[model samples]
Target chain A: MDKTQQSHLLIEDLSVARGERILLGGISLRLSSGQIAEVTGPNGVGKSTLLRAIAGFFPVRSGRMSWVESEAADSAPLAERLHYIGHLDGLKSALTARENLEIGLRFLGRDRRTPLQALDRMELAHVLDLPVGYLSAGQRRRVALARLLIVDRPLWLLDEPLTALDRHACALLKAIVAGHLGSGGLTLAATHEPLGLPGTIQVRLGTR
Target chain B: MTRILLVIFVRDLMLARRIGGGGILGLVFFLSLVTVVPFAIGPDLRLLSRIGPAILWIAALLASLLGLDRLFQADQEDGSLDQMFLSPAPLELIVLVKCMAHWFVTGLPLVMLSPLFGLMLDLDGPALRSVAATLLVGTPTFTLLGAIGAALTVTLRRGGLLLSILVVPLAVPVLIFGVSAAQSATISFLTPFLVLCALGLASIALAPIAAAAALRTAGE
Candidate 1:
């Protein structure tokens, strides 16, 4: 296996709150390259909130997170090195699948693969020209998933990535996650279902 | 940075075009405001001409707000706004790009059609030219400042009304200077026009920062 130098992410005693309720508290984790952390719990367990905190979507009420590239502490903006897919799918209703993928890659400043190639990898080649709003829920999820492939970011924060996926699409997702891990990348997924990837670390969250 | 900005700008323009309502809605609102003023004031051509600049500025201001709610609302609903937060480009730059795109789609057409609307209100050559020119320079400031309000109200369900309330007060100076520039076209148009430009330049520099901060807080 051709392995690049690993990146390290450390979170210490993280806490998140919404209004008067504490969603998560005293959470800590360390992830390096080629690692996958699966956040599993029932609904309203802060699985999504934890992922959002790591992706910098929500404020961390306490504690800190540090990302180190190779041997040095990387102070570059987290967004530059991470790709985040949330529950909304992020597809513009008027745009085609290909256009969404292309614009998404450009917006992220990643140009590794063409939109067509990325959609092809997601088995969306046949519907490349159709508007995303016209796509089914499963198909739209595939298009969003295709963004992870088009952009070559090291850290992927996926919130319920498999929610709308069918059996075949779920298999494709597993393959993609595995392939991403094989190439010294990090994935933090918040899902209720089993990710079923080898050597994955499971972090279960519950109401505080 | 330029490439990313261009990509966002182009994508927004495309969305505005395909979505098929924002620009047209603003233009139609502008047209109705122009046409209705004659009826409301009983077809007094001189009176219409006298208040033409104010009417046009008022109409333009209201029309600009017609689609302001959609500025960030659609992106927030569809989750592209969150994706935008993750872009390497600073959120301020993204806000700037979105504002520019909004101006291009909504403001530009209103400016282009203002002269015709001015003619309807019996504005002569100098008056019409001044109105168009003022709109060309002033509407960008309107859109930029309005972007902040839009960002602030993006998370709300009926944000359109609140957006107008928030934006209209901030727009008072632009309205005053814009109408003044048109009224003084026969005198020293340069002075008020220059002031309008200054306000525009200031808004261009400041609104994006404020709007980006509002968006971040709203996300939180």
Candidate 2:
């Protein structure tokens, strides 16, 4: 597979289960470059499970999920081309905000902007030196949001990216998602509230 | 790949330092265990020397298990383990890095302080040296085995007791060979030491893959 080719995700009749309980089934979707898909549903409706399955965190009981090149049969592994942000922000409380972002960028193994630049974009420059344990819930969310900007991946799998944010932070997150879409990237976000992004295809999961 | 592993290693070490009582706490626990033995058994120098190697080994083993519960707990709780699972680097490599960091933080201190405890137990020079040698070679195996237990119980809220139960049985071989190697250092030292080395090598090669599989299945 050519490394430069863009990724096109295809999910065909995917089903997921948690122990004896089946969460969601018969789900199918296609996301090409520069597309955004919002997975919306009520609580306990398998919204997070669908995103996790795409991120390879959950096993798909039936059907296939693949990331194929635009013109070739060869496909890239989803893990290499995607970023996943779940309910818990992956931050170490002992480290400063800048330190956490730097570690995240380094772990992603991508050539990208400096951690300070990402934090600055998130309007967290004033608290860059503060340990993440001392930050407010909203500030911590922004720091985690900055992680999405520090690396350049083709796909993003975000679960509830707007849980603890104020109205302004929500607007900031929407703008960040918009910018990611503008740059020919793909986003699959699961949220209870509307993502408020234009042209976003909604995947509403019904409760089991 | 090396850079990413280094970042994780350094981050884990920093957490061990900054978080509540990591390396120092392990050392203090080791010291208290060493100090309490004399009181329990009554102050007898011959008895102390006779049992010093076993006592020191037991203390080191228990100290090594002190921090094992937190091996993956913090990462699992903070959701970093999920991100790590999705990284371009393999999960086995990440698990290996974590185990190495854990050993460095918790196990190395006990090995370094075993000689002091050995002296306090009235061990002679040769006995002290041999106890330290066996501990240095054997503690990593204990740590690697404990990591499998840690990963298996990562999802449980109170996994410390279960971790001890699961890991102690697996660590019996290390304990046996560790004590034997120290006891027979004056005689045929090569055989027991070689067996201990083999156990350590096997744990190094196999534990990470097993632990990584456990971590994956845990999320499922």
The backbone clash count of each candidate, in order, is 0, 0
Per-residue CA lDDT of candidate 2, range B31-96, in tens? 999999999999689998888898888988898998888899889999999889767788888889
Which residues of candidate 1, in runs, are more than 4 Å off? Answer: A71-75
Q: Candidate 1, residues B1-220: lDDT per residue as tens digits?
A: 7888999999999998898899998899899988888999995888889999999999999888888888998999988988898888899999999999999999999999899999899999999999999999988999999999999999999998899889999999999999999988899899999999999999999999999999988867
Residue-by-residue lDDT tens digits, candidate 2, A62-128 = 9988887665663547787888988889999899998898889888877577888888888889999
lDDT of 1 at A125: 92
How much does candidate 2 score in TM-score?
Answer: 0.97
Lowest summed lDDT over 10 consecutive residues: which window, candidate 2 chain A? A1-10
Q: What DockQ does candidate 1 score?
A: 0.81
